[model samples]
Target: MSEDFKKKFDDVLNKIKRELDSIAKRIDEYLEKGEIYRAYRIWRDAVLDSLKMLRNALNTLGEEFKDIKFSEDDLNNIAKYTREGIREIVDKLEEIGNRIRELRGRGYLWIWFDLKPIKDLFQEVAEEVNVTMDGVLSHVEKFISSLEKAFEDTGRRASQVVSVRIKEKDLELIDRLVEVGIFRSRSEAVAFFTRRGIESSKDWIEKALEHAKKIKELQEAIRREIGGEEGEEDKENQGKP
Candidate 1:
């Protein structure tokens, strides 16, 4: 499950991991220069300037998807990962956050001259962590939504063999694809183009679907109106002046 999701979204996940590493390094620098609290309005977190939490979070993210292949583009393999693996990641992050909050009450980072900023700094830091976590969750949600749509589209396209009656020119184009070694046979060429067309015009396809639904609703409404009028006419006729 983990490997499957990682494969489909390897590029995205790599970018995210790199970004995390960059951010972690920046925070480590802050801890080194003793500017941690200054930047955070009081006190804050870290990456590798002597910290276990930061290492754990970064490692958890990186180690899971290391050495992944981009070979599998199918969603069926990743559907389980979408549900389980994603939750595992989110849960790991939440665990890190919970640890931070647990330590927040200890006045560890509260070391200061007057100790007046302790409460404020702790609250601010926790709030920042929560906000960051929220952003992560939101990004995951959007990614999952995209995967779901892709899965739905794939399912529709791959349900059965579509017997399409093509014009000669279209058939010739399919044959050309085969001739160029782009596909093994006419069936492969057709399937590839059919999927490609759906993918390329996915937005338009969604809009068309929306319009079709509205059209169905409109037809139903018109039928209901006609039925109501018929009921009125029947009542009048039965009443017979």
Candidate 2:
């Protein structure tokens, strides 16, 4: 990941974490004062905002980790679990909406807005979201760690993660390789074939890309010179182990 991208990702993730905490506090304050009606709009607005944030977070994860394929020990069904979590949260939010509307429809009865049920609902949703968000956050943080680790130690034999889309036939071919025990996993099979394919094109690539290689070398030299001029910081001070 690029430095600019890492900064933006951190900002987005922090905003999401802050938003959820703030939403709960705001709603609780209104509910505590026996202002169920006042909490209604806050609840509705929070739902919309939360949904937007959830989607943005998911999209960011997908984009940032698009190349980082997960093994069974890594990110498992990120899109699926995150989407399902979003759906459940939305459904809970909808239930809260319906309850608020029902109370509002009564419109005039002092006793109609019991507030207890909705309060319970707020608690339920909080618990649900906390559990779901924990999973999402852990996976993202893990991805960031993995990305940084790989980038920093190019020569280290780290367990790299790569994710990508494949056609039906392509997926079947990968699976077939795994089934035959030629590879331990779909990731392994994909990596093997991909490396092999690149090697097969080495001759043509070298012949046709001579100018490009020189340009790339120039860019690398410039980057190296800039690093030297700046006196690179210690990894330990930068939060490395």
Q: Pick the candidate with the highest lDDT.
A: 2
TM-score of 2: 0.30
Residue 135, model 1, lDDT: 34
Show how many residue pairs clash in every candidate, following the order shown: 1, 5
For candidate 2, the lDDT comes to: 0.48
Candidate 2: which stretches are off by over 4 Å?
1-25, 28-37, 70-76, 104-241
* Lowest summed lDDT window (length 10), candidate 2: 154-163
Off by over 4 Å in 1: 1-6, 38-76, 83-241
Q: What is candidate 1's local distance difference test score?
A: 0.42
- In the range 1-241, model 2's lDDT, one tens digit per residue, is 3334344555654675566567667766755544444565566556556546655665676566656434432333332344345445545555555444454222321212212332333233334433333354554444334423432342122112111333445556556545544456554555555666534644654454555556668999999998876665654456765
Clashing pairs in 2: 68-162, 68-163, 69-161, 69-162, 69-163
